[model samples]
Target chain A: DVKVTQSSRYLVKRTGEKVFLECVQDMDHENMFWYRQDPGLGLRLIYFSYDVKMKEKGDIPEGYSVSREKKERFSLILESASTNQTSMYLCASSSTGRNQPQHFGDGTRLSIL
Target chain B: AQRVTQPEKLLSVFKGAPVELKCNYSYSGSPELFWYVQYSRQRLQLLLRHISRESIKGFTADLNKGETSFHLKKPFAQEEDSAMYYCALSGQSDSWGKLQFGAGTQVVVTP
Candidate 1:
């Protein structure tokens, strides 16, 4: 079974602070994604990396950035955190197939003060 | 624009009762849909995919293009069936498996 590990289960940061959320997948999958899960809005994609050094902005990429220096690790970066950015963040990884199912990590619940 | 929609935010049902979670999507090209479940304190996992056409854990969903709906159904609900359900569409607009997810529905099964 594939395992996706998130660095944190709970995170707290102050407004205007920079934040980093790390995710690692053991299956050597080529695709990685970052999403913010909100109650009414559901999970909205922030950024995704299909390969090392390649990234694409998803629907809700504002206030967020990503890094994929290696295949197994993907990191989401908040250049300047705000209170509105507090939400549950999820990381997912998948193989290179249209029909492949995404494997998700236990999310990090972030609270920005 | 490609999008997925799960209309209900919460669904409460009794054990042994029939349960259905509605999911609808809007996409321009060929569509592939999937249902995901997240149990309490557990990571989200794939429950079933429409392309696979296989029932998982007694839950089955059929894609209806005319209705643009992929409603998940179970004949007899179990106590363990309670969870957060999400409907997702694989994005064809971009190459990689970027998914468009819907606002999830929370199912609660009571005795």
Candidate 2:
């Protein structure tokens, strides 16, 4: 089974503070994704990394960025945390295959004060 | 651009009753649809996919290309069936392993 682990389950930060959310996958998957899940909006992709040192912008990438220095780890960075940026952050990983399912972490509920 | 839509925000059903969760999508190319379930305190996981045509935990979804819908159906609901269900659409031609997710439907199965 694929295990996707998020570094934190809950987080609190003040506005304008720099925030980092870490994710690690043990399955050696080639794809990693970061998403912000909100009520009534479901899950919106923030950033995705297909390989080490490579990243792509997702649907909502204005305030967020991602880094994949290592293949098994992907980190999401909030340049300046804001109240609107607070949400449940989810990390997912999937192996390269046809119709492969992405394994998700438990998620991190972030609160920006 | 592709979009996934789940019309119902919440669905309530009694144990042993049938349940159906509707999902619709607007995509130009060939679409791959999937159902994901997030139980309380658990991570979101794939329940079933249209390509698999297989049932999981007594839940099944059929893709209707003509109607652009993939609705999940369960013949008998159980208390454990209560969860947040999300319908997703994958764009095979445009991207890899990226999915468009619906807002999700919260299902409550009471005894």
Candidate 3:
């Protein structure tokens, strides 16, 4: 079974603070993604990395950046968090194949005060 | 722009009743569709994909290209089947790893 582990199940951060959400996958997938899940908005992509040091902006990449220094780990960074940034963050990984289904982590519920 | 639309936010049914969750998509080219389920306190998992044409957990979905819909259906609803279902689409020209998802439907099966 594939395992996608998130560093935090719940997180709290203050406004204007830097925040990091980490995700690690054991399946050695080549594609990793960061998404924010919101009510009525579904899961909107924030950023994705196809390979180490290669990143692309998704539909909602503003105020967020991602790091993929290694194949197994992907990190989402919020340089300065705000209350609007509070949402359930999910990390997913998939093989390079076109039709491969993504495996998702348990998600981190972020709260910005 | 590609988009996935799941119109229902919540659906309730009896344990033995049939269930259906509707999903529609707007894409210019051929796209891959998927149904994902998230059980309470569990990670989101893939239920099925259109390309596979296989039924999972007693549920099946058929892709209708004319209508651009992929509605999930089950003959008998079970309490254990209650979960949040999300419809997702891929296969955009430039975005391979990106999936556009719908708002999701919360299914509640009453006993």
TM-score against native, each model: 0.98, 0.98, 0.98
lDDT of 1 by residue, A4-106 (tens): 9999999999999999999999999999999999998889999999999999999989999999999999999999999999999999999987788999999
DockQ of structure 1? 0.78
Question: Which lDDT tens digits does candidate 3 get at residues B1-111?
Answer: 888999999999999999999999999899889999999999999999999999999999999999999999999999999999999998756345578899999999999
lDDT of 2 by residue, B1-111 (tens): 999999999999999999999999999989888999999989999999999999899999999999999999999999999999999988966355888899999999999
Q: Tens digits of per-residue lDDT for model 3 on A1-113?
A: 99999999999999999999999999989999999999888899999999999999999999999999999999999999999999999999998765789999999999999
**What's the interface RMS deviation of candidate 2?**
1.4
User: What is candidate 1's local distance difference test score?
Assistant: 0.94
Order the candidate numbers by DockQ, best to worst: 1, 2, 3
Q: Where does candidate 2 stray beyond 4 Å?
A: none
lDDT, each prediction: 0.94, 0.93, 0.94
Structure candidate 2, residue pairs in collision = none
Between prediction 1 and prediction 3, the one with superior lDDT is 1
DockQ of each: 0.78, 0.70, 0.67
Candidate 1 chain B lDDT trough over 10 residues, lowest sum: B90-99
lDDT of 2 by residue, A1-113 (tens): 88999999999999999999999999999999999999899999999888999999999999888899999999999999999998999999998754999899999999999
Roughly what TM-score does model 2 have, to 2 decimal places? Answer: 0.98
> Candidate 3 chain B — worst ten consecutive residues by lDDT sum?
B90-99
Predicted model 1 interface RMSD? 1.1
lDDT of 1 at B8: 98
